[model samples]
Target chain A: MTERKLIVSRRKLLRVGALGAGGLMLSGCDSLNRSEGFRSLLEGAEDLHKGFQRLGGEGALAREFAPSDMSPVFRANGNREIADSAYRQMLAGGFADWALKVDGLVEKPLVLPLAALQSLPQRQQITRHDCVEGWSAIGKWQGPQLSRILDMAGLKPQARYIVFHCADRFGSTPYYESIDLIDAFHPQTILAWRMNDALLPERHGAPIRLRVERQLGYKHAKFVMRIEARDSLAGLHGGKGGYWEDSGDYAWHAGI
Target chain B: MSEAVTSDHFKGGDFVRRHRLSTRIWHWINAVAVLVMLMSGLMIFNAHPRLYWGEYGANSDPAWFEIGSNADGQGLVKIGDATIETTGVLGVWTDSEGVVKKRAFPGWATIPSNYSLADARLWHLAFAWVLGLGVVTYLFWSLLNGHLWRDIRMSRAELHPKHVWHDISEHARLRFPTGAAALKYNILQKLAYSGVLLVLLPVVVVTGLAMSPGMDAWMPWITQVFGGRQSARSVHFLCAFGLVAFFLVHIAMVVLAGPINEVRSMITGNYRLPKDREEG
Candidate 1:
């Protein structure tokens, strides 16, 4: 009788917990439905999206397709040419002097040259790149996993966000993007140096570019020049994390 | 049984419950949600005026449908080899500032009444939460209450060609059922409602999910079932248009059949039965 009572009570508790979780989800949607301000609506909806994805996406890997499924033309989106003289010089010397500086809240600061990056063990993935403008293209990318670099850098306990500084600039604003540690540690996240078995071209961000497979196109930072680990995104450009987020209405987190 | 009231001028007149409370609530909420989603979605579609098939499509790829303006400043919508001019409307229209611009889906119909894809997405995703959740919950509740079988499901008699033909012709003539018959759905009504509920709604949601790269991780079959991302998008695009067409027909039927009674029935759940004609 005692054992039976305990099991019944535990089942009741489980029922209540499920009801509460469902109610909480409803309230999250309710606020988005009721909010009048655009910014509040944006923030609330984004959080809802993040929470929904986090529940089921912890260990899930993005779907990979066969090489035969690759798109014939993977059009490079955003800023076609870099006007900066330093980037041109790096291009001229074939990125011989170019190096990615990884600093900020890290136990060890490391600057890895292009050659050093290529020397690391690489993971090749053929994944589709989805653009916010409603276009998709599949391309194979090979590079060192971002998790490996973070392991080598040894992030300090205070580190919460990893910001990517880039050589490419859109108009006057230098391009940059940031991601939470969860995304930073994803196995598929890589600083790719090669596309389709060839060296990464300038239009696709040479030397190295970040390939976050699960996100929209803009989050894949091209012409990446630096990586900084930080505690908060508060003081970053536009305080929202990415160049597009600052200038346009693009969501900083494009997981959806 | 024809029951005559104290006044025998009208026979078999009575009040009937046409919709449940939950159904009414879902219906009203869906009205707002679908409108918001549709308008914002138009703005998102404006970002890419061209539509294609297969796995990939961009400026370089061959397009099956496109909205563009010609050199003489005339707007046109092109689908395959055929083209139709739509100046001052879809392809080319002046904004609030009165400056003529070449754009798909003019500003008025879009959210914010401006060209902001970011804000448009915010509105789209925001209302999509309501639209998606409402449908799912409503369907669940409907099943538990046997509302699907009791009301939505058609009877064997309903599938008879003669019964369907009668309903279709009556609806075409703008003549609706009266008295006790008005309590249950006619054949045409059941077909339209079932089409919207079981077919169009699910197709739009699935194809929309298939477009999301994140969802690709969760359900690879979502993309696979639709063939590819671009193919899914095209299907999603067509389904949305189908929904809009349904909405137009719904509104028109309501108006022609007597908006006061139809709208009141949906709102308050009490419908006043139309007068029965004798010798019919």
Candidate 2:
């Protein structure tokens, strides 16, 4: 009877020990998961994030620029041509006759020549061009703000995005870019005609290029031939609205 | 006979399986994400190699060092046909008069100049999204399933001064108790893991996002909280340091706590308990 009692006690002790260990394990897990301390920590972090967001506020404007700061040496960083022979011939003649057709979701659908664009109320801005490739250059750019041009063209109410179709090409694909309405009307957003004081060189988009100052270098579209107003970017190449956007996984909103 | 059957049924021994599948998945995922983040982060640090807290630079004229020389105080280099001893950036250079000149010590080594800043930014930002998503998902799933509470909660007894001292003394002596009790993590593990998950990771993410120019419009308060852009950057680096410390401790724990058994449990969700010779 004593032997049997001893065996029973040992079994009971083992079982009790296991239960105690298991309970501790479960408690430790609970502390990690639902403890007041951890919850407060998480809440504090989230509160900080929300508070920052609140302080910054939505639709805050980036700095605008004057024309004197455009870089004297503005170098093109990517491909420079539309592989078609006809386009090359047009380019050789200085593209004077080349008309920039502004259409699609615009009431006026105006086709303005480069000279006509030059004659328009011009804006010159000397601003810093920050590249995603980690370089910055201050340069003066001469052109009309896209907002004024769009206003003249009279964008339809349905128009939400301004797409820049360029003369450059990558393989069989023609280079194209687009920006939303916020950037579209931004004071710094201009279709630049001249770099520094001279007319833009062929390497620097020749007659015209874009200077979306608030964004990184890739957003600065070059070799402009047409400006199309669209309601959505869905039908565009890769549906992301820029050359690098399609080729590289570049964010559609390269705001920084 | 009925008692024997009942005891047999109770001894199934399956519930003590190592780590749950979810825990294992989260652990390994965090491991990979943290490693990639650290490597890329180190590359980015090369931009300003010296670290400083607050606004001061590294005391203007920073003390610097170079690597690759032996302790014999003799410089050594192999020429076309013979070995030459030289020091400094000029090394063993023949002057315009055909006289060989040796300077003392080579140029100071800078941080590793392997990556471009822009490329590093892109990689960091892109991978950041992955890490953020993983963390969020882990938190949500763990919360929903009650895993967090189950693993990290402590009892009043465990919180006692005696128990805490016992743990500390055992740790100091490197005396890890082996048994089912030891199979479960001690209090320190729970605290460190919780602190990292609930505190450090979120702080790093917030500071990083706060430093972005685009997010400035939406989250200016983050800048205010951290003092400024540079301050936020400093905090981000500090939080990253905390995470690295946690990672080192965690690895050490894994090594000490029967690496194979622990690793297999994480991978396969099963662990065989050490056989109890007393019962046998």
Top-lDDT candidate index? 1
Error of 1 at A211 (Å): 0.4
TM-score: which candidate is best?
1
For candidate 2, the TM-score of chain A alone relative to the native chain A: 0.72
Candidate 2: which stretches are off by over 4 Å? A1-149, A156-178, A186-252, B1-15, B44-123, B154-166, B273-280
Docking class of 1: acceptable
Give candidate 1's TM-score. Answer: 0.89
The DockQ-based CAPRI class assigned to model 2 is incorrect
Tens-digit lDDT track for model 1 on A123-164? Answer: 999998988988888899999999999999999999999999
lDDT of 2 by residue, B1-280 (tens): 0112112223322335557677788887877667556655654554444332321122231212111224554444433335455543323334335544332221111011222443344446555766777888888887887667767667788778899889989877766644455455577776787788788887888777755545644555765587644466667777987998997887787677556555656666756443343543
DockQ of each: 0.25, 0.09
Q: What is the C-alpha RMSD of each candidate to the true structure, in Å?
A: 10.7, 14.9
